[model samples]
Target: MTILVEKPVLALEPKDVSNKDDSEKEMAAKNGFFAPEINSFGNSFRDYNAESARQSTVEEFYRLQHINQTYNFVKRMRAEYAKLNRMEMGIWECCELLNEVVDDSDPDLDEPQIMHLLQTAEAIRKDYPDEDWLHLTALIHDLGKVLLLPQFGGLPQWAVVGDTFPLGCAFDDSIVHNKVAKQNGTTLPPAALFIIRFHSFYPLHTAGAYKHLLNDEDAKSLNWLHIFNKYDLYSKSKDKIDIEKVKPYYMSLIEKYFPAKLKW
Candidate 1:
């Protein structure tokens, strides 16, 4: 029943994926508009709980995410994206690039990439007539997933989406596939019940998850993340959003929600 069926969706760029060093690729991504901290979280949440599947679920997250996302890594990201060089292109192009692939790892979605965005935006527009920013939220919250692209920062599916949690603090118990806590070293005592949940973004709702860490724009966009994530995570179906018909409606919504010009 996985909607993200294994379609021949990903298209290799004409230039081919470069084997350039990680640091060089990171720098190139900055020049192209990739954001920071998005890669900080990997598919940590996607790992199975344990070797036996019954011997107390333990996720292989700490073994990887801890090393990939170190203190220095966060600081390096901050320094890189502060200049925002990576995104010198049009936003539409980024969306199109992202649209080239589907999140096959996701169980509930079977739609095209663009259709998924439309579904999320349309679902919100149905409820809140006046919340213009919500339309923008639905459209952009998953922009971080563009990291799947090489130019944007070729991140794995596990990194881009899953139940999101806080970094500096401890993990929470509300995680959907809640076995990730069983890694050899994954302890829950000190940061008891700090687990991150689905649709968590607003500092208001998430008990200041990223409030202190995020800048104003990221914080403000937290609303859109909150509003859109409802559908991003839940709005999937065997059905799909009609691309031709839904495009104009979404454009209007985006116009209403976002300013005429955005940085990336």
Candidate 2:
């Protein structure tokens, strides 16, 4: 059965920071806020060049992820993991777990995942101090990658991380390897969920390719998701942040939004 879907015309223009609140502007100045750029390696960020040291491994990771991330596999994974029976720990503990891990799929930075989380959250906080929810959202967006740990199902990097896309629809060209799904069992706010699920769905947000699948609410959330992609994707750097200094602030946020201990 073939059905025709009309893509909505969206005026998703970029927001001007020049007119932002004075406090935010001041914060940006103090923090050296600027648009994200390519890494020091002289390659474009996420460039999978065959000659690059990280490219072969990154490509292989995506190759496996693309081949195995099928619809039935997704369903099976959701059923297995949704029980959330793995461990009971505070959110900061989960963040600490990532210190032992690095993302093999990433070509830009090779630091531990917790460093990336802190870099992303700190970058966003500098530009939008009032948006505490957004700051928290950046901190924990990749917590799902803990699936790589032996205690939490020990899933392969292919199954746990990489660019994401919608599964039942066409694989848009903007998404890397272009395959995916939404999640369930999350108690996060709609906006946070939008960022968590679709942050990897670059085809829709970056290329404007999945407008036909979106309704009014999806469109509204898309705005914030766009704002978040900047920090999530491009905030990696060699600059180190002192974890002890910032840990208390993020712990407070976790306590506010999440219970003292979560199921996973």
TM-score of each model, in listed order: 0.54, 0.84
Q: Give me candidate 1's TM-score against the actual structure.
A: 0.54
Which 10-residue span in candidate 1 carries the lowest summed lDDT? Answer: 186-195
By TM-score, the best candidate is 2
For residues 1-264, write the lDDT of model 2, one tens digit per residue.
853433223234535453447687666667746644477455777666635777877888888887888888899998988887787888899999999888988888788999999999998887777667777889999998899999998999989988876676666667675442222223346777788778877778888887888989888989888888877776787888899999999987776667677786
lDDT of 2 at 55: 80
lDDT, candidate 1, at 212: 64
For model 2, the run of ten residues with the poorest summed lDDT: 179-188
Q: What is the lDDT of candidate 1?
A: 0.46
